[model samples]
Target: MNILVTGGAGFIGSHLCDLLLLQGHSITVVDNLLLGRKENISHLLNRDDFSFMKEDLLNLPVLKHIFENGRFDMVYHLAANSDIQKGSKDPGVDYDLTFNTTFNVLQCMKEYDVKKLFFASTSAIYGETCDRLTENYGPLRPVSNYGAGKLASEAFISAFSSAYHIQTWIARFPNVVGERFTHGVIYDFIHKLQANPEILTVLGNGEQIKPYLYVKDLVEGIQFICEKACERFNVYNLGSDSRTKVKEIAAMIIEEMGLDARIEYTGGDRGWVGDVPEFKYDLSKINELGWCAKHDSNASVRLAIQKALGK
Candidate 1:
């Protein structure tokens, strides 16, 4: 199969590309290097089966040109603004990079007669819900521009699927961590400690708990759901079974880095605006499909720290 992955040079997407190539599929990666680093997919540039395009998904004409030449069978949409606060600062970023990218991708796919797509969705679409979030659980209100944009993308995906017979797999992921991480709590903590090892300042009150899924585990879920779940539209919550607190993550990072830093709280329920301080994913749907995350949140945190620290 020939696969086209938007944002395939980024953290999770690059991992997806690796798995695809290992499975004997030829892949063409289109990434503008916004959140994606060239280094992430640099290792694949030399291969015959792998190709990388330094292009933005928001540019529809160029995307269309690529689609015409590629003859792609499957499309994986992962391009989006990774930062909530950054998008909150400028809603246009989320609009162009997150939502518009999906819209444009769907348009190109429709024009090119591509039938299958895999979307990298997020749990943030659930908002600050108290209940364990299921694929069917919704009032689907996202507080942040980032989540709002992704939710909007999912809506278009559903529309495109129904209006045109496109098969789609949507995985709502938790906070993913591991190697090649561009930004997130663990990455931020590592950089902060490197700057000042004496004091590690935490964003919120340190009680925010959310599941952390390893990136590898996530891509495996993608592969599993991609192969097994046959439907016009399939959605699943891909995450760890257990939850870990932010303070606990901080403590683990502190211990792993051998830092004597004092953990300081900024005193808030969440790290920033548009942040969901607490949430849980009900993986019952995927579990019933015979797919589950091997690492719990705590183990994911520690393993991610080790990979980040290169220990």
Candidate 2:
């Protein structure tokens, strides 16, 4: 199968590309090098079956040309604005990066008659909910601009899939952590420690709890769901069974980096204005499909820290 991964040069996308290539599928990755780092997929650049295009999804002409010429069997739309914090600050940031990017991808897909789409949605779309999020949980009230953008994109994907007869898989991800990870709590914690080993300034009150998934577990889950959940449109919550707190993650990072830092809270329950205080996902939907996350939230954080520290 010829597969097109929109953000194939990023953390999760690159890992997915590696697995796809290993399974003898030809893969082409299109990334803008914004949040995605080229080094993430650097090893696959020399492979005959793997191709990289440093192009933004917003470029419709280039995207249309690539789609028309390549004739991709499936499209894994992994491209998006990764910085949730930034989105909280400026709503327009996510609108352009996440929502517009998906619109462009869908338009190109329609033009090229591409029928299959695998989208990367987020748990943030659930908003500041206290209940465990399910696939059917709705009237999705997203708190952050990032979440709003993703929800809008999901709606577009569903509409496009229904109208064009495209098979679509939308997986709502938790905090995904592991190798090649560019942002998030783990990444932020490590960088802060590196700069000041003695003072670890944590945002919020440090009680914000959320489920997280290891990158490998996430990719594997995606592969499994995509293979088994063959329907007109499918939505699954991809995450670990358990949850973890912000302070717990800080402690983990501090221990992993061997730093005895003074933990200082910036003072607030939420990390940012749009940040959800606490949320966990119910993975029974996917678990019923004979798939489960191998690593718990704590283990995922630990492994990501180890990889980040090069240990």
Candidate 3:
């Protein structure tokens, strides 16, 4: 199969590309390199089954050209403004980057007669719900613009699927952590502690907990769903079964890095203004589909810390 991965140079996207390539599939990567690093996909440049284009999906002309030339069988749309904290600051940017680009991708798919689309959605769309989040969660009340954009994109994809007969799969991921991670709690802690090993300043109180999934496990789950699932519009929560606190993550990083860092709380309810304080995912659907996450949140944090520290 010939696959096109948008944002294929990013942390998750690159890992997806690696897995796809290993499966003997030809892949064309489309990345703007705004947040994605070239080095992430550089290792695959020489391979005969891999190709890359350094352009954003927001640019219609470039996207059209890629679509016309590549003629992809399946598209994995992982490109978007994924930062919740940053999205809270400038929502307009998030809307443009996510909704607009997704619209363009759907347009290209419609025109080119593409078969399937795999969208990367998020748990942020659920907001602050008390119950464990399921695929059929009621009324998406996204606190941040990032979640709103993802939900909006999902709606567009659903509409496209209904009108144009495009098969789609949506994966709502939790906090993804692993190797080559550019940003997030683990990366932030590593950088902060590296700068000042004596003291680690946490963003909020230690009580906040959320599910975390290793990148390897995430990629495997995606592969399983794409291959085994037959639903026209399927939504699954890709997250670890366990949850870990932010302070616990910091402590794990400090211990893993062998640093004598003192944890300092900033005294806040959430990590950021629009951050989701706590949430749990009911992964019964994915688990029923015979895909289970191997690493828990704490284990993922420790391993990610080791990978980030080059240990």
lDDT for predicted candidate 2 compared with the true structure:
0.91
Off by over 4 Å in 3: none
What lDDT does candidate 1 reach at residue 79? 91
Q: What is the lDDT of candidate 3?
A: 0.90
lDDT of 1: 0.94
Better of 1 and 2 by lDDT: 1
Candidate 2 global Cα RMSD: 0.9
- The deviation in Å at residue 290 for candidate 1 is 0.2
Candidate 3, pairs of clashing residues? none
Clashes of each: 0, 0, 0
- Model 1: how far is 25 from its true place, Å? 0.3
Each prediction's RMSD to truth: 0.6, 0.9, 0.9
lDDT of 1 at 274: 96
Worst 10 residues of 2 by lDDT: 268-277
TM-score of each: 0.99, 0.98, 0.98
lDDT of 2 by residue, 71-113 (tens): 9999999998889888878888899999999999999989889
TM-score of candidate 3 on Cα atoms, chains taken together:
0.98
lDDT winner, 2 or 3: 2
Error of 3 at 212 (Å): 0.6
Tens digits of per-residue lDDT, candidate 3, 176-211, equal 999988889998888898899999999888789999
Ordered list by TM-score, greatest first: 1, 3, 2
